[model samples]
Target chain A: MSRIPEETLRVADRLAAAMAREMRDDRVAGAALPLALLAALLARALYAPDLVVLGSLGLPLAPSAWWPGSGFRLSLARAEALALRHADGRFALEDAFASVFRGRFAIWISPAQVDATGSANLSAIGDWRRPKVALVGSRGLPDDAGHIPMRYYLPRHEPRHLPAAVDFRSAPGRTPEDGRRGRRRGGPEVLVTPLGVFRFRPEGVVADSLFEGVTPEEVTRRTGFPVTGLPEAGRTPPPTAEETAWIRRLDPFGIRALELLPPREARLAAAAIAEAEGEGM
Target chain B: MLASLTDVAARVREASKAGRLVAFGGSGLHRKPLRAAEAIAEAAVPDLRLLAPLGGPEVDLLVLAGLVRRVVFSYVGFEFLGVAPAFRRAREEGAIEVEEWSEFAILAGLRAGVLGLPFHPLPGPATGDLARTAPLAEVRSPYAPHEPVAVVPALAPAVAIVHVPFAREDGTAFVPGDPYADRLVGLAADELFVTCDELVGPGEVPGPALFLAAEVTGVVPAPGGSCFTASPPFADLDVRGAIDYLESVEARLARPSARAAPGRAGGGRGR
Candidate 1:
């Protein structure tokens, strides 16, 4: 075997170390990090609890999100990424995930969008073959930085039986596109980096003025690749009283990865936000 | 034989420059570092248009870095073995052209090419995602989707090479797995070169290798050389050698010209 350079060796070591975390509390949850992420993320995001995740190779989320029942909340001093649940039976793709988790929402963020660059699994969100991990926001959970579908209480699409509501703005990338001028689109808003903290947006990613200790190149390279655009320090939009009443319930962290839309693409972004009735993102 | 991977890259660069339509295929980037790296560097040529089954580091870098004009692949990530950074970057840039395929369908297409058929008819569940992407997969009742299309034109290569564990003076050889693709590629070639561990005789050709003797050319033995082509157990090129070669030809791969004289890539590796 070739003796690897110290730098490449270091990168490899860091990657190996970062891959050892989990988000759930059961043996199946911790052991089946891949299956859980695929199922939970899709369940929570698209409100499709039945979408079965087939094996997808190269999907990094597996080794990344090690456990279950985890959420990415910024207000906490510490964080936990997994919870416990019995292993559901095998999954079936022919079954429509779109209908199962009809009104759920699970927020997703790429490693490219986070400051914890190493924390991000580059192929996790990109791959569709394996049951990938769903622990996103290695940067942080989404907030109402901009778009708000007026947090509904119950699930949205399953309008008849279940209802949900949650504030999905400020949390991260602009949802529903055209809704926000490009400023709020394309990139993640909150960033928790190994180097420091920052935010990203369509205009460009910027180090919070307070953490000027890091360089943009350092941020970009450390994050595995170059980063652009970030959310601007602009006016904050408040939710209307009418919009607040609309959010009734939520059902997050119960579906699979295939069910959720591409977080950044307009054609595939999440269409509705269901309250986390009893689930986690 | 080339002294190192750099030498191989030089050949690839020359092939691209001569207007040869370059085609590349391999399983994924896993335990095999040398072959993987060489594949990445070769695929990163600037001017040569990258043709792939999907988008990933090599294909992406080829496009995003402006080395390749376009890429043809079904799914980049699905095709990745484990580590793939170059593909992710290329995809993010939208400097890509996407084509979709099922694992079976893609293999069938290659088989069709190897078999010298125009297109192979597919046979499988032709519903949902696979249907939307593989339009050619849709055919008449007997010519169902996913079966190899009717006639996959041959994929004759200007020069085809593969990395193997063994090779000998007379040219007979053996590869680890199902050698269908390599067989087709070799049959479709005017000159086929294989780079292997050492020049072995009948003693090494066991099991599967024992059977595939007539199909292969001799292994071009080179101590510091990397088998810069098709793979299995996997091997690498000389590192300093690779660095020296790629660093020197960085410019050639960035903005390739469309001047390839694509020879007829036609033939079949009769299994």
Candidate 2:
């Protein structure tokens, strides 16, 4: 291990501490937070996509839970030590679950409900004991949110999903107590939906940018909580010609577009794709 | 032991005759032993308790066949296609008992079973409705005492069916990348059966072999057994086939006659 100068080490520590404080205070909506986070990371000269751990890359497998040999063991202290070792500009892509347990990764997960506080609900819609609707139980969000940066991806940005307060806190966001205690190094980063990208601020969820043809009025009217649009918030940029070509090439079946479309349209598109693929076969 | 697919299916039927807990191995949409599951479904076995850490078509198929009495699972859904059709329908109809756990909790439970321990404690505090709904208990560590650990009970399956890319007649298998808790499933089951795409000769088994060969009760050569999901080296996921299977099942369920005719033999032909 290369020995770092004392002054450089102290400066890095101080910068990290400040960034953590700012991250704790920032409520995550979807669009601009990525840029903000990226800028902050770049300032620290630690912005390497390869070095940044990812929770999943479209694999069907849900991130693993606590298994000694399988998933990373569920020990924060041990995971912290592991994270410390990877504080250098290199991250090992050992296991998705391992990287998650180390709390040095970012995740884009869909939750049943999200609140202004950035808390996520993926467990149940009704009461805890006898739920009217039982969702997939909290997989790793309970252990993950406080430790790792989390960005939400919701197909629909409706009042039902963006509730005032989630029924259950599957993955906790910043709160008054959290702020006071300086807990949660990693929390909500952004919430991306079809209509717009949102960020969590101390006040509430703020609209960072509306998608093409989406209006601020539509976003505000749809959200369960009061959503304020940033003064400079504008239309989300359309994909560049090159980007569009790349996307078309990579996703010939338009599977990624399924996430942005309505359910009925998505189903139709899927059926069409299947038919096309069937014909090819 | 090396056995024919039909013979292995027969063994599964015999082992699960008592309405035993049968765990299906594989993560969502990846190398699921669906062929074995299909055989069991075709046999029209009933009253089996189903278990999976992360399930896809394997769990849904059994549920659709009306063979599952109870389901102990972390998550059981088609990845992007949305909620599993049969599992969702069964849950909505209150036809099967559901015990939900986190992926970690399931792993911990299986680990407990593998170690012959009564329970295994998950690190950190339990969160969300799972802490209330899941079959977990709280016990303080003797050393710490201050921190209470959420403990999941041992979940030993009566039979575990796992799919592998390659295996030998002696039951040794090559599992590339993540086993996805199949090893745990093998060790935690009373009888572990593996269905492989290629049943190679003893010396022909390739890759770094790491699995419960000793615990595996039987090995069946089942080429393309993990289809519709994935079995790397043979093929990637047959997405169209999977979607077609889902739609076909949904259509069948929509029919009035089929509504009353679940668990019927020969139901596996839809796939």
Candidate 3:
């Protein structure tokens, strides 16, 4: 019944495939990403009126693609202008925790590393004093996870990220002993990776479902901790053709393609050094 | 009265020497009055403590210049780029004192200050490292002693600097995009200085009034003041320029005499 284009659907399909699981609620707040964009479109398609998507500064209101190395840009200039003109619609970063605490707010966060228990690290790798790599420091993950329910999104499912324990507990997940704390302040509920969907359980993380063409062994191999209570290997439901077409209509520029590749590879490939070397020769 | 950018910076420098705490507006590269802050750093005033809700290049530049003695902030990093090199180096060397608060705590502290409240209570477990080091104190709820709450002390900075798109001679400032915590910073500070791309008459300013003239101590017109940060209507974030600045900073840090190159601090334009 929808008149959405086929090309748009293909792009949305890739995004929806990466973010396969359904959210508990239609409303969410998070930094802009390909998966987050897909979730927004999915929420809209479901006719959810409470859909409120909050983006960080300069993040596009809709799905966008960064030029190979230029970084993210608003896909539509008009949309960018509109967003700027209605700037009051955007929430203040300082009020982020207050919103989470006020309740009926769900957040989808992507951290550098996540452990089996749903604990996350966005600060650093290795020692805290002299880290092997220092990432953007913990912004609101600690308070958000400590106060409200959160979901995780990992575009690249790798062993390093799905570690047994995070190098830093930027945000502590729910544990058996943390029942009282968890009840007072909700914790992470589910994790959606490129390969599959996982739910954090008191026992450990259990596989909710695996993406099509992805094997249980592959998921287990990529994860650092043993995935307990594997749900009878079910296929991640694919987005319908109509849904994909509608998403493409929403994002005409195929911005979702940028996320299809690993960030490290993309950065290196788009590095100024490589471009300069080519130009010099 | 409209003041020159240098005069504004001089005011900040003078205040810093008195060991006053200063707050800065914006997150990442949005609405940061970096040029004026850099000017303050270049002045090399001592005993200055900074209170930033979120940190970026402005904080890094100050740390690199050894102008800041203490900093109260939630996080300090270059966002997706990497850790703020100067902040990391300073922290590792124990060159500066840090009062780490969670992002919410900083905001709540400022809000409490604006409202003239003693402290704002945050609901959560206050057992984290930041909660231990910061000014947050645990107290039994008066309504329910069983319910524990973390209360963050109110923050009243001596001065707050923010960048806006436009301003009037009377000191009213307008922000084209999200004001973030600029308004809160303005209200919480004893004195507020706003740097804008354009200076106009009272009625000519566009957008909502982000900072009232009564609270604003001064307004200075400095085009492209945010530079690498988005000034909007004026210019978008100069990402290429930011990348260039980051590369230069990295190169300088990698040099053998990197520590001796403090003279180069505040030499470059805002980015």
Q: Highest TM-score: give the candidate number.
A: 3
TM-score per candidate, chains pooled:
0.38, 0.75, 0.83
| Highest lDDT against the true fold, candidate | 3
Q: Model 2: what is its DockQ?
A: 0.17
Model 1, position B256: C-alpha lDDT score: 52
TM-score of chain B of 2: 0.92
lDDT of 1 by residue, B60-100 (tens): 33443445544434434311012233343334444433334
Model 1 per-residue lDDT tens digits across residues A1-281: 02223332222222111111111211111111222233233232233223322221111123212233333211010111121011122221112112112222122222222221111222223342321321111111111122211111100112111112111121233234433332222233343222333444444344442122445545444443344432332222222332122111111221212122222221111111112211223
Q: Candidate 1: misplaced stretches above 4 Å?
A: A1-281, B1-21, B30-46, B49-66, B74-83, B96-98, B130-137, B141-159, B177-181, B184-191, B202-207, B210-218, B222-271
* Candidate 3 local lDDT, A1-281, one digit each (tens): 02223443344464464453354354544453444655654554444434554444333233222113222322311223335543335555555555677764565677889998888877667765556665566667767766676678775789998899888777777665686643466677888877777888888899887777788888888899999656585777766676565555544444444344454433332233323322433
For candidate 3, what is the DockQ-based docking class? acceptable
Task: Say which prediction, candidate 1 or candidate 3, comes out ahead on DockQ.
Answer: 3
Report how far residue B192 has shifted in candidate 3, in Å: 1.0
Ranking by lDDT: 3, 2, 1
Task: Give one digit per residue, the lDDT tens place, for model 2 in A1-281.
Answer: 01223332222232222232233322221111112222222222222322332112211121221112232211111222222222222221223445455564444577889988899987667664455665655665665665567777665678999999998888777777664433435668778776667788777788877666777777878888888865568765544454333333323343444444454455565556545544643
Clashing pairs in 2: A27-A200, A27-A201, A28-A199, A28-A200, A29-A191, A29-A198, A29-A199, A29-A200, A30-A191, A30-A198
Q: Rate the local accuracy (lDDT) of all candidates.
A: 0.31, 0.62, 0.66
Deviation in angstroms for A251 in model 3?
A: 4.9
Best by DockQ: 3
Candidate 1 global CA lDDT score: 0.31
